[model samples]
Target: MANPHSDHPAHLQHHFVSSEQQFDAAKMGMWLFLVTEILLFSGMFVAYIVYRTWHPEVFAKSAELLNPFLGGLNTIVLLASSFTVALGIHYAQKDNKKGLVINLVLTFLFALTFLVVKYFEYTAKFEHGVFPGAAFDPHGVSHGVDYATYNIPYARQFFSIYFVMTGIHGFHVLVGMGLFTWITIRALKGEFSSAYYTPVENCGLYWHLVDIIWIFLFPLLYLI
Candidate 1:
Protein backbone atom coordinates (compact mmCIF):
# COMPACT_ATOMS: atom_id res chain seq x y z
CA MET A 1 0.00 0.00 0.00
CA ALA A 2 1.94 3.03 -1.24
CA ASN A 3 0.72 6.63 -1.00
CA PRO A 4 1.39 8.78 -4.09
CA HIS A 5 1.00 12.15 -2.27
CA SER A 6 3.52 11.39 0.45
CA ASP A 7 6.26 13.18 -1.50
CA HIS A 8 4.26 16.43 -1.39
CA PRO A 9 3.81 18.47 1.77
CA ALA A 10 0.43 19.90 2.73
CA HIS A 11 1.91 23.26 3.65
CA LEU A 12 3.65 23.75 0.30
CA GLN A 13 1.95 26.20 -2.01
CA HIS A 14 1.00 25.15 -5.52
CA HIS A 15 3.17 27.89 -7.04
CA PHE A 16 6.27 26.63 -5.25
CA VAL A 17 8.27 23.81 -6.79
CA SER A 18 9.19 22.40 -3.38
CA SER A 19 8.96 23.13 0.33
CA GLU A 20 12.55 24.44 0.37
CA GLN A 21 11.73 26.80 -2.47
CA GLN A 22 8.66 27.99 -0.61
CA PHE A 23 10.67 28.66 2.53
CA ASP A 24 13.33 30.55 0.61
CA ALA A 25 10.74 32.67 -1.14
CA ALA A 26 8.97 33.49 2.11
CA LYS A 27 12.24 34.50 3.77
CA MET A 28 13.17 36.72 0.84
CA GLY A 29 9.81 38.45 1.04
CA MET A 30 10.26 39.06 4.77
CA TRP A 31 13.68 40.57 4.16
CA LEU A 32 12.21 42.91 1.59
CA PHE A 33 9.58 44.05 4.05
CA LEU A 34 12.26 44.60 6.69
CA VAL A 35 14.20 46.74 4.23
CA THR A 36 11.18 48.99 3.83
CA GLU A 37 10.88 49.22 7.62
CA ILE A 38 14.52 50.25 7.91
CA LEU A 39 14.05 52.93 5.30
CA LEU A 40 11.07 54.35 7.17
CA PHE A 41 12.92 54.45 10.46
CA SER A 42 15.98 55.86 8.74
CA GLY A 43 13.99 58.95 7.82
CA MET A 44 13.13 59.53 11.46
CA PHE A 45 16.74 59.02 12.48
CA VAL A 46 17.84 61.61 9.97
CA ALA A 47 15.32 64.07 11.34
CA TYR A 48 16.60 63.47 14.85
CA ILE A 49 20.17 64.04 13.73
CA VAL A 50 19.33 67.22 11.90
CA TYR A 51 17.46 68.66 14.86
CA ARG A 52 20.18 67.71 17.32
CA THR A 53 22.88 69.17 15.10
CA TRP A 54 21.02 72.44 14.72
CA HIS A 55 20.39 72.76 18.45
CA PRO A 56 22.75 70.58 20.43
CA GLU A 57 22.21 72.45 23.69
CA VAL A 58 18.43 72.14 23.46
CA PHE A 59 18.67 68.47 22.64
CA ALA A 60 20.99 67.80 25.56
CA LYS A 61 18.98 69.80 28.07
CA SER A 62 15.70 68.30 26.90
CA ALA A 63 17.21 64.85 27.23
CA GLU A 64 17.69 65.58 30.94
CA LEU A 65 13.91 65.22 31.37
CA LEU A 66 14.11 61.58 30.22
CA ASN A 67 14.90 58.72 32.57
CA PRO A 68 17.90 56.83 31.32
CA PHE A 69 17.53 54.11 33.94
CA LEU A 70 14.09 53.24 32.65
CA GLY A 71 15.35 53.35 29.10
CA GLY A 72 18.21 51.03 30.00
CA LEU A 73 15.87 48.63 31.77
CA ASN A 74 13.62 48.48 28.73
CA THR A 75 16.66 47.81 26.60
CA ILE A 76 17.51 44.80 28.77
CA VAL A 77 13.96 43.53 28.64
CA LEU A 78 13.86 43.66 24.84
CA LEU A 79 17.23 41.97 24.53
CA ALA A 80 15.97 39.17 26.74
CA SER A 81 12.88 38.86 24.58
CA SER A 82 15.00 38.52 21.47
CA PHE A 83 17.05 35.79 23.16
CA THR A 84 13.93 33.90 24.22
CA VAL A 85 12.55 34.08 20.70
CA ALA A 86 15.80 32.67 19.34
CA LEU A 87 15.50 29.84 21.83
CA GLY A 88 11.95 29.23 20.75
CA ILE A 89 13.13 28.90 17.19
CA HIS A 90 15.84 26.52 18.27
CA TYR A 91 13.31 24.42 20.11
CA ALA A 92 11.05 24.35 17.09
CA GLN A 93 13.89 23.15 14.91
CA LYS A 94 14.59 20.43 17.42
CA ASP A 95 10.91 19.44 17.51
CA ASN A 96 10.76 20.20 21.20
CA LYS A 97 7.20 21.41 21.42
CA LYS A 98 7.16 22.08 25.17
CA GLY A 99 10.36 24.10 24.99
CA LEU A 100 9.07 26.11 22.07
CA VAL A 101 5.82 26.90 23.86
CA ILE A 102 7.61 27.94 27.04
CA ASN A 103 10.06 30.18 25.25
CA LEU A 104 7.39 31.82 23.17
CA VAL A 105 5.34 32.53 26.28
CA LEU A 106 8.40 34.08 27.89
CA THR A 107 8.88 36.29 24.87
CA PHE A 108 5.26 37.41 25.06
CA LEU A 109 5.58 38.29 28.73
CA PHE A 110 8.71 40.29 28.07
CA ALA A 111 6.96 42.29 25.34
CA LEU A 112 4.08 43.04 27.70
CA THR A 113 6.55 44.19 30.32
CA PHE A 114 8.11 46.59 27.82
CA LEU A 115 4.74 48.14 27.03
CA VAL A 116 3.83 48.45 30.68
CA VAL A 117 7.05 50.29 31.40
CA LYS A 118 6.42 52.56 28.46
CA TYR A 119 2.98 53.32 29.82
CA PHE A 120 4.39 54.58 33.09
CA GLU A 121 6.86 56.75 31.22
CA TYR A 122 4.08 58.21 29.15
CA THR A 123 1.99 58.91 32.24
CA ALA A 124 4.89 60.71 33.89
CA LYS A 125 5.20 62.97 30.87
CA PHE A 126 1.46 63.60 30.87
CA GLU A 127 1.52 64.56 34.54
CA HIS A 128 3.70 67.49 33.52
CA GLY A 129 1.62 68.42 30.46
CA VAL A 130 4.45 67.23 28.24
CA PHE A 131 2.71 65.89 25.16
CA PRO A 132 3.65 65.82 21.51
CA GLY A 133 2.87 68.42 18.83
CA ALA A 134 0.66 71.40 19.61
CA ALA A 135 -0.28 70.11 23.03
CA PHE A 136 3.37 69.95 24.03
CA ASP A 137 4.55 72.13 26.93
CA PRO A 138 8.18 73.09 26.69
CA HIS A 139 7.98 73.99 30.36
CA GLY A 140 8.36 70.40 31.47
CA VAL A 141 10.19 71.78 34.47
CA SER A 142 6.96 73.46 35.60
CA HIS A 143 6.58 70.50 37.94
CA GLY A 144 9.78 71.88 39.55
CA VAL A 145 11.91 69.09 38.06
CA ASP A 146 14.58 71.48 36.78
CA TYR A 147 12.73 74.73 37.67
CA ALA A 148 15.13 76.62 35.40
CA THR A 149 15.74 77.05 31.68
CA TYR A 150 14.09 74.67 29.01
CA ASN A 151 10.98 76.84 28.39
CA ILE A 152 12.23 77.65 24.88
CA PRO A 153 10.44 76.44 21.73
CA TYR A 154 13.49 74.42 20.69
CA ALA A 155 12.78 72.01 23.52
CA ARG A 156 9.54 71.16 21.76
CA GLN A 157 11.49 69.83 18.81
CA PHE A 158 13.27 67.28 21.02
CA PHE A 159 10.15 65.97 22.79
CA SER A 160 8.21 65.90 19.53
CA ILE A 161 10.83 63.74 17.87
CA TYR A 162 11.06 61.53 20.95
CA PHE A 163 7.32 60.90 21.06
CA VAL A 164 6.96 60.16 17.36
CA MET A 165 9.95 57.83 17.14
CA THR A 166 9.17 55.93 20.33
CA GLY A 167 5.46 55.84 19.60
CA ILE A 168 5.99 54.12 16.26
CA HIS A 169 8.45 51.70 17.82
CA GLY A 170 5.96 50.90 20.61
CA PHE A 171 3.32 50.12 18.01
CA HIS A 172 5.73 47.65 16.43
CA VAL A 173 6.32 46.04 19.81
CA LEU A 174 2.58 45.69 20.32
CA VAL A 175 2.28 44.06 16.93
CA GLY A 176 5.10 41.69 17.78
CA MET A 177 3.28 40.66 20.95
CA GLY A 178 0.19 39.87 18.89
CA LEU A 179 2.16 37.89 16.34
CA PHE A 180 3.85 35.87 19.08
CA THR A 181 0.49 35.23 20.74
CA TRP A 182 -0.92 33.75 17.53
CA ILE A 183 2.13 31.64 16.77
CA THR A 184 2.42 30.44 20.35
CA ILE A 185 -1.06 28.97 20.00
CA ARG A 186 0.08 27.30 16.82
CA ALA A 187 3.19 25.98 18.53
CA LEU A 188 1.00 24.47 21.23
CA LYS A 189 -0.96 22.66 18.51
CA GLY A 190 2.34 21.32 17.17
CA GLU A 191 2.24 23.39 14.00
CA PHE A 192 5.97 24.04 13.90
CA SER A 193 8.73 21.49 13.57
CA SER A 194 12.11 21.16 11.89
CA ALA A 195 10.65 20.70 8.43
CA TYR A 196 7.92 23.35 8.74
CA TYR A 197 8.88 26.15 11.10
CA THR A 198 8.69 28.94 8.55
CA PRO A 199 6.23 31.04 10.55
CA VAL A 200 8.39 30.95 13.66
CA GLU A 201 11.52 31.78 11.68
CA ASN A 202 9.94 34.73 9.94
CA CYS A 203 8.47 36.12 13.16
CA GLY A 204 11.81 35.88 14.93
CA LEU A 205 13.48 37.93 12.20
CA TYR A 206 10.87 40.63 12.72
CA TRP A 207 11.24 40.60 16.50
CA HIS A 208 14.98 41.02 16.18
CA LEU A 209 14.54 44.09 14.00
CA VAL A 210 12.21 45.59 16.57
CA ASP A 211 14.87 45.09 19.21
CA ILE A 212 17.57 46.62 17.02
CA ILE A 213 15.52 49.74 16.40
CA TRP A 214 15.09 50.27 20.14
CA ILE A 215 18.82 49.87 20.65
CA PHE A 216 19.40 52.87 18.43
CA LEU A 217 16.54 54.77 20.00
CA PHE A 218 17.68 54.44 23.63
CA PRO A 219 20.98 56.25 23.25
CA LEU A 220 19.59 58.77 20.80
CA LEU A 221 16.57 59.69 22.89
CA TYR A 222 17.66 59.15 26.47
CA LEU A 223 21.44 59.40 26.59
CA ILE A 224 24.09 61.65 25.11
Candidate 2:
Protein backbone atom coordinates (compact mmCIF):
# COMPACT_ATOMS: atom_id res chain seq x y z
CA MET A 1 0.00 0.00 0.00
CA ALA A 2 1.28 3.49 -0.85
CA ASN A 3 1.74 6.05 1.88
CA PRO A 4 -1.03 8.68 1.82
CA HIS A 5 1.27 11.47 3.04
CA SER A 6 3.82 10.67 0.37
CA ASP A 7 1.22 11.18 -2.33
CA HIS A 8 1.07 14.91 -1.46
CA PRO A 9 3.41 17.05 -3.58
CA ALA A 10 6.16 19.31 -2.27
CA HIS A 11 5.45 22.53 -4.08
CA LEU A 12 5.23 24.36 -0.73
CA GLN A 13 7.99 26.46 0.79
CA HIS A 14 10.91 24.70 2.53
CA HIS A 15 11.45 27.41 5.14
CA PHE A 16 8.60 26.06 7.25
CA VAL A 17 9.78 22.41 7.05
CA SER A 18 6.17 21.18 7.25
CA SER A 19 2.75 22.01 5.92
CA GLU A 20 1.34 22.97 9.32
CA GLN A 21 4.27 25.26 9.95
CA GLN A 22 3.67 27.05 6.68
CA PHE A 23 0.01 27.42 7.47
CA ASP A 24 0.79 28.86 10.91
CA ALA A 25 3.26 31.27 9.38
CA ALA A 26 0.69 32.45 6.91
CA LYS A 27 -1.88 33.01 9.68
CA MET A 28 0.61 34.98 11.76
CA GLY A 29 1.57 37.13 8.81
CA MET A 30 -2.06 37.78 8.04
CA TRP A 31 -2.70 38.93 11.59
CA LEU A 32 0.21 41.32 11.34
CA PHE A 33 -1.14 42.64 8.09
CA LEU A 34 -4.53 43.14 9.68
CA VAL A 35 -2.97 45.13 12.51
CA THR A 36 -1.40 47.46 9.99
CA GLU A 37 -4.71 47.77 8.20
CA ILE A 38 -6.41 48.76 11.44
CA LEU A 39 -3.82 51.42 12.06
CA LEU A 40 -4.31 52.79 8.58
CA PHE A 41 -8.05 53.26 9.14
CA SER A 42 -7.60 54.47 12.69
CA GLY A 43 -6.09 57.72 11.51
CA MET A 44 -9.18 58.48 9.49
CA PHE A 45 -11.46 57.59 12.35
CA VAL A 46 -9.57 59.87 14.71
CA ALA A 47 -9.91 62.74 12.29
CA TYR A 48 -13.62 62.07 11.98
CA ILE A 49 -14.11 62.00 15.73
CA VAL A 50 -12.22 65.27 16.20
CA TYR A 51 -14.16 67.00 13.47
CA ARG A 52 -17.43 65.61 14.79
CA THR A 53 -16.60 67.01 18.21
CA TRP A 54 -15.63 70.40 16.86
CA HIS A 55 -18.69 70.58 14.65
CA PRO A 56 -21.29 68.35 16.22
CA GLU A 57 -24.07 70.02 14.26
CA VAL A 58 -22.37 69.28 10.98
CA PHE A 59 -21.98 65.61 11.84
CA ALA A 60 -25.57 65.45 13.03
CA LYS A 61 -26.91 67.02 9.85
CA SER A 62 -24.65 64.82 7.77
CA ALA A 63 -25.95 61.73 9.52
CA GLU A 64 -29.47 62.67 8.56
CA LEU A 65 -28.48 62.89 4.91
CA LEU A 66 -27.54 59.19 4.93
CA ASN A 67 -30.22 56.53 4.56
CA PRO A 68 -29.94 54.13 7.48
CA PHE A 69 -31.86 51.51 5.51
CA LEU A 70 -29.17 51.21 2.92
CA GLY A 71 -26.51 51.17 5.59
CA GLY A 72 -28.35 48.38 7.40
CA LEU A 73 -28.63 46.36 4.20
CA ASN A 74 -24.93 46.68 3.47
CA THR A 75 -24.12 45.64 7.02
CA ILE A 76 -26.15 42.45 6.63
CA VAL A 77 -24.51 41.71 3.31
CA LEU A 78 -21.03 41.98 4.80
CA LEU A 79 -21.87 39.90 7.88
CA ALA A 80 -23.18 37.11 5.63
CA SER A 81 -20.03 37.23 3.56
CA SER A 82 -17.94 36.96 6.70
CA PHE A 83 -19.83 33.85 7.75
CA THR A 84 -19.31 32.26 4.34
CA VAL A 85 -15.63 33.05 4.46
CA ALA A 86 -15.31 31.39 7.86
CA LEU A 87 -17.00 28.31 6.49
CA GLY A 88 -14.63 28.27 3.57
CA ILE A 89 -11.72 28.02 5.97
CA HIS A 90 -13.42 25.19 7.82
CA TYR A 91 -13.93 23.26 4.58
CA ALA A 92 -10.35 23.76 3.58
CA GLN A 93 -9.19 22.41 6.93
CA LYS A 94 -11.13 19.20 6.37
CA ASP A 95 -9.65 18.78 2.94
CA ASN A 96 -13.14 19.03 1.51
CA LYS A 97 -11.93 20.63 -1.70
CA LYS A 98 -15.34 20.90 -3.34
CA GLY A 99 -16.91 22.46 -0.26
CA LEU A 100 -14.05 24.89 0.04
CA VAL A 101 -14.38 25.98 -3.57
CA ILE A 102 -18.14 26.45 -3.31
CA ASN A 103 -17.92 28.58 -0.17
CA LEU A 104 -15.13 30.67 -1.66
CA VAL A 105 -17.06 31.26 -4.87
CA LEU A 106 -20.08 32.31 -2.86
CA THR A 107 -17.97 34.69 -0.83
CA PHE A 108 -16.61 36.20 -4.02
CA LEU A 109 -20.15 36.71 -5.32
CA PHE A 110 -21.09 38.41 -2.05
CA ALA A 111 -18.18 40.79 -2.49
CA LEU A 112 -19.42 41.61 -5.97
CA THR A 113 -22.89 42.32 -4.63
CA PHE A 114 -21.36 44.65 -2.07
CA LEU A 115 -19.58 46.56 -4.82
CA VAL A 116 -22.81 46.87 -6.79
CA VAL A 117 -24.68 48.31 -3.83
CA LYS A 118 -21.80 50.68 -3.17
CA TYR A 119 -21.94 51.80 -6.79
CA PHE A 120 -25.55 52.82 -6.40
CA GLU A 121 -24.81 54.65 -3.15
CA TYR A 122 -21.94 56.52 -4.77
CA THR A 123 -24.03 57.33 -7.85
CA ALA A 124 -26.81 58.77 -5.74
CA LYS A 125 -24.36 61.02 -3.95
CA PHE A 126 -22.82 62.19 -7.21
CA GLU A 127 -26.16 62.96 -8.84
CA HIS A 128 -26.94 65.22 -5.91
CA GLY A 129 -23.53 66.88 -6.15
CA VAL A 130 -22.64 65.62 -2.67
CA PHE A 131 -18.98 65.09 -3.38
CA PRO A 132 -16.07 66.43 -1.29
CA GLY A 133 -14.58 69.94 -1.47
CA ALA A 134 -15.75 72.36 -4.17
CA ALA A 135 -17.39 69.51 -6.06
CA PHE A 136 -20.05 69.38 -3.31
CA ASP A 137 -21.75 72.47 -4.63
CA PRO A 138 -25.36 71.36 -5.10
CA HIS A 139 -26.04 74.66 -6.84
CA GLY A 140 -29.36 73.74 -8.42
CA VAL A 141 -29.93 70.09 -7.51
CA SER A 142 -33.17 69.08 -5.81
CA HIS A 143 -33.52 66.81 -2.75
CA GLY A 144 -36.45 64.87 -4.28
CA VAL A 145 -34.16 61.92 -4.97
CA ASP A 146 -32.30 61.22 -1.70
CA TYR A 147 -33.98 62.37 1.52
CA ALA A 148 -32.90 65.54 3.44
CA THR A 149 -31.87 68.71 1.67
CA TYR A 150 -28.08 69.31 2.01
CA ASN A 151 -26.68 72.83 1.77
CA ILE A 152 -25.35 73.66 5.24
CA PRO A 153 -21.91 75.20 5.76
CA TYR A 154 -20.48 72.43 7.96
CA ALA A 155 -22.43 69.73 6.10
CA ARG A 156 -19.81 69.80 3.36
CA GLN A 157 -17.06 69.25 5.91
CA PHE A 158 -18.94 66.30 7.36
CA PHE A 159 -19.26 64.75 3.93
CA SER A 160 -15.58 65.36 3.30
CA ILE A 161 -14.67 62.99 6.13
CA TYR A 162 -17.47 60.61 5.21
CA PHE A 163 -16.25 60.25 1.65
CA VAL A 164 -12.65 59.82 2.69
CA MET A 165 -13.42 57.08 5.22
CA THR A 166 -15.85 55.14 3.05
CA GLY A 167 -13.76 55.64 -0.05
CA ILE A 168 -10.72 54.12 1.61
CA HIS A 169 -12.84 51.26 2.92
CA GLY A 170 -14.23 50.67 -0.57
CA PHE A 171 -10.74 50.61 -2.01
CA HIS A 172 -9.83 47.91 0.51
CA VAL A 173 -12.76 45.89 -0.75
CA LEU A 174 -11.48 46.12 -4.30
CA VAL A 175 -8.04 44.97 -3.23
CA GLY A 176 -9.60 42.03 -1.36
CA MET A 177 -11.49 41.02 -4.50
CA GLY A 178 -8.21 40.66 -6.35
CA LEU A 179 -6.65 38.74 -3.49
CA PHE A 180 -9.55 36.31 -3.26
CA THR A 181 -9.51 35.82 -7.02
CA TRP A 182 -5.94 34.66 -6.85
CA ILE A 183 -6.76 32.34 -3.94
CA THR A 184 -9.67 30.87 -5.86
CA ILE A 185 -7.50 30.08 -8.86
CA ARG A 186 -4.95 28.43 -6.64
CA ALA A 187 -7.68 26.43 -4.95
CA LEU A 188 -9.11 25.28 -8.30
CA LYS A 189 -5.73 23.81 -9.16
CA GLY A 190 -5.86 21.67 -6.00
CA GLU A 191 -3.04 23.61 -4.46
CA PHE A 192 -4.40 23.44 -0.93
CA SER A 193 -5.05 20.24 0.95
CA SER A 194 -5.45 18.97 4.50
CA ALA A 195 -1.69 19.15 4.82
CA TYR A 196 -1.22 22.53 3.20
CA TYR A 197 -4.11 24.96 3.11
CA THR A 198 -2.36 28.01 4.46
CA PRO A 199 -3.45 30.19 1.59
CA VAL A 200 -7.09 29.52 2.31
CA GLU A 201 -6.74 30.12 6.03
CA ASN A 202 -4.71 33.26 5.57
CA CYS A 203 -7.11 34.69 3.06
CA GLY A 204 -9.96 33.89 5.41
CA LEU A 205 -8.30 35.98 8.12
CA TYR A 206 -7.92 38.83 5.71
CA TRP A 207 -11.60 38.61 4.81
CA HIS A 208 -12.63 38.68 8.44
CA LEU A 209 -10.55 41.75 9.11
CA VAL A 210 -12.31 43.49 6.26
CA ASP A 211 -15.63 42.62 7.82
CA ILE A 212 -14.51 43.79 11.24
CA ILE A 213 -13.50 47.17 9.88
CA TRP A 214 -16.92 47.62 8.30
CA ILE A 215 -18.63 46.74 11.56
CA PHE A 216 -17.12 49.83 13.20
CA LEU A 217 -17.41 51.91 10.06
CA PHE A 218 -21.15 51.29 9.63
CA PRO A 219 -22.07 52.67 13.02
CA LEU A 220 -19.60 55.54 13.00
CA LEU A 221 -20.33 56.69 9.49
CA TYR A 222 -23.98 55.74 9.17
CA LEU A 223 -25.65 55.47 12.53
CA ILE A 224 -23.72 57.94 14.68
Local distance difference test values of all predictions, in order: 0.91, 0.81
Q: Compared to the true structure, candidate 1 yields what TM-score?
A: 0.94
lDDT of 1: 0.91
Candidate 1 Cα errors over 4 Å, as ranges? 1-6, 138-144
Error of 1 at 168 (Å): 0.3
lDDT of 1 by residue, 1-224 (tens): 39656778878777889889999999999999999999999999999999999999889988888999999999999999999999999999999999999999999999999999999998888777778888876344544675236557678888889999999999999999999999999998888889999999999999999999999999999998
Instruction: Give per-residue CA lDDT, model 2, range 1-224, as digits (tens).
Output: 57545644585564556666666777888899889999998998898889888988778868876778887888888888889888888888898888888888888888888888889988877777788877786544445543335677778888888888888888888877887889889899998877777777777888888888889988887887
Each model's TM-score? 0.94, 0.90
Instruction: Please report, as a residue range, the 10-residue window in candidate 1 with the lowest summed lDDT.
Output: 139-148
Q: What is candidate 2's CA lDDT for residue 12?
A: 55
C-alpha lDDT of residue 206 in model 2: 81
Best by TM-score: 1
Query: Cα miss at 118, model 2 (Å)?
Result: 0.7
Which RMSD does model 1 reach against the true structure? 2.1
